[model samples]
Target chain A: MKKIFLSLIFLAILTTGASAQVKMLSLPQLQKRISNPDTVYVVNFWATWCKPCIEELPYFEKLQATYKSQPLKVLLISMDFESKLPAVKTFARTHKLASEVYLAQRKSDQELIDAINKDWSGALPGTLIVNGKKGIRKFQEQEFTYDELNKLYQTNK
Target chain B: MKKLVLLMLIAVSSMAFKLADGGYKVGDTAADFKLKNVNGKTVSLADYKAAKGYIVVFTCNHCPYAKAYESRIMDLDKKYSAKGYPVIAISPNDPVAEPADSFEKMQELASKKGYTFPYLIDETQDITRAYGAKATPHVYVLQKTAAGNVVKYIGAIDDDTENTKADKVKYVEGAVNALLSGKQPQVTATKAIGCSIKWKKSA
Candidate 1:
């Protein structure tokens, strides 16, 4: 009974550790992730403190689940300061989000914002959908619903 | 011919929306506004008869980014109020959309922080819309010229948000200083990661 209990605790810790890995991405690294011709990447720029971003996050998760079998990736890139990484990790863990979570590593916000889309004004809840092969890059600096996300993904396809 | 005219009308309206979305650019004349201050007084940029310019900042109470820059913004008012470039902060958040940014909260924050400048509420949000303010702590430096308040600069207050750097560029200060010295700011605009201005439901 003691062995079984100890192993269960160990298994829980292992799973938690695996899921706690939040990748740090700079502009170039982020660009590389979406460059794959076979995969469609939906990169969402958000922060833990942004209410609107938090509200619409579940929609992205739903979109990811609905397209799980497809060559699509949903990346939630946090715009929170790097010092707030612990808070971001806690948020992702507590929320149990399935999308790939990343912390943006940039020297300046302009570098990342302008690189992604010139139309973007470095606001929270911004999303970018990119398909390298299709040569499609759509960006919206606003919150999205599940149906809207799905429709945008479809239209882009 | 009827279809073409209808299409032209549609195009014109859509173009107006687009123009509204892209707020005030540098060198453009900014319109003055009558907004209620935290002190329960109706204030306008035109009310400051002795002022030469204004450091109009669109900021709010709850945003983490705004909270981080609160002290810095106060310092801007302190250093420039005597110089005629007083900081006039405007809370542009919709109270319905963001309850923490209501007028009461704005007054609470102003008193708690002991703000030196007038912290005003853009009640109608028409001023915010006209200014094209999109983010909290968005800075717009205007110079009182013969034509009117000419926007000298727009964008971030500085280069670093974390406030950890010793050599960070102070964009707002530079603009205000340049205008004081009868010179144009070398750096006119910048971008920073900020909380979006909470628009009312219809907006």
Candidate 2:
């Protein structure tokens, strides 16, 4: 009976971990998520080499937390190399990120740039807030204050 | 959500790079502006005139990203300037906040590196803004004409970071070649990879 109970507990734990696994989506899936009818999304394009992007990530998390009551979601899309996915995954795991995470799969900078925004001049820490009613508001750079974020949220609401 | 916040803080402390802009066209006349160079001499778009083309690059002293392209910038001038495409570099950061990017240090670095081009300083940070220069080592390639000098390309020096890869695509070189051959560059604008320009937050 002890052996059976232990096996059952192990199985339960495995299943739970599997269910909670983070999904890294492709561009198509990412676009679908962005275009989803009900889910308001905040998509941020960042890289590990960029200082400002790293500095402002915490604020994005705070913004995500503040909107937990709503159907809003935060997506962090890393522009790191595809080969660095392991490193990125380990980094994400180490950081304990709960928000949805993705690695942009575009090989060329042009492709990635077009994927984010046509007008973007390849600036780091770019952010896009998409809402059903408000459409999309994109910030080309970082250094956003909490009040500015809140104002964006408030206006969208 | 709270978990996410904790995670972001941890993530930030671990990594240093930031995302740069991508997906833009090139081949437009650059906006004219004047900025001080490292020698304390004011340089402007009108200063360097080439019958064929010119190169305007926004660079800084301390950024690792800028450091990566230092040699390349020198090479660009050495290779092309005599070919009627002189490269002009500008420092867009404030002297107070980033002392390494000051005019004095710029001269020191340029002299040490034996830079063949004019290294200028944008003291007011206005010219940097006018060009929408967001990062260190940002490049704008231009061509001179009877009408005026027109911007031919704007983007990274090459697709390689630290210049060590077979997969690297030399964007600036390709563009310059295209212009030399009197043909439009296959790609005008490219995504820049470097450090963000440290702009002062207004009081």
Instruction: Please give, for residues B1-203, the per-residue lDDT of candidate 1 as tens digits.
Output: 99999999999999877766677999889989889999999989999888999999999998999999999999999999999999999999999989999999999989998999999999888889889888988999999988999998989999899899999999999999888999999999899999998988883
| Candidate with the greatest DockQ versus the true structure | 1
Worst 10 residues of 2 chain A by lDDT: A15-24
lDDT, residue B182, model 2: 90
Off by over 4 Å in 2: A1-25, A93-95, A132-140, B1-28, B31-34, B44-51, B95-100, B161-167
Model 2 C-alpha lDDT per residue in residues A25-79, reported as the tens digit of each score: 6777777778864767778877766666777777777888888988788888886
- The iRMS of the candidates, in order, is 0.8, 2.4
lDDT of 1 by residue, A1-107 (tens): 99999999999986865365687888899998888989989999999988899999999888888889999999999998888888889898888877889999998
Mind sharing the TM-score for model 1?
0.92
Candidate 2: residue A85 Cα off by (Å): 3.4
TM-score of each: 0.92, 0.76
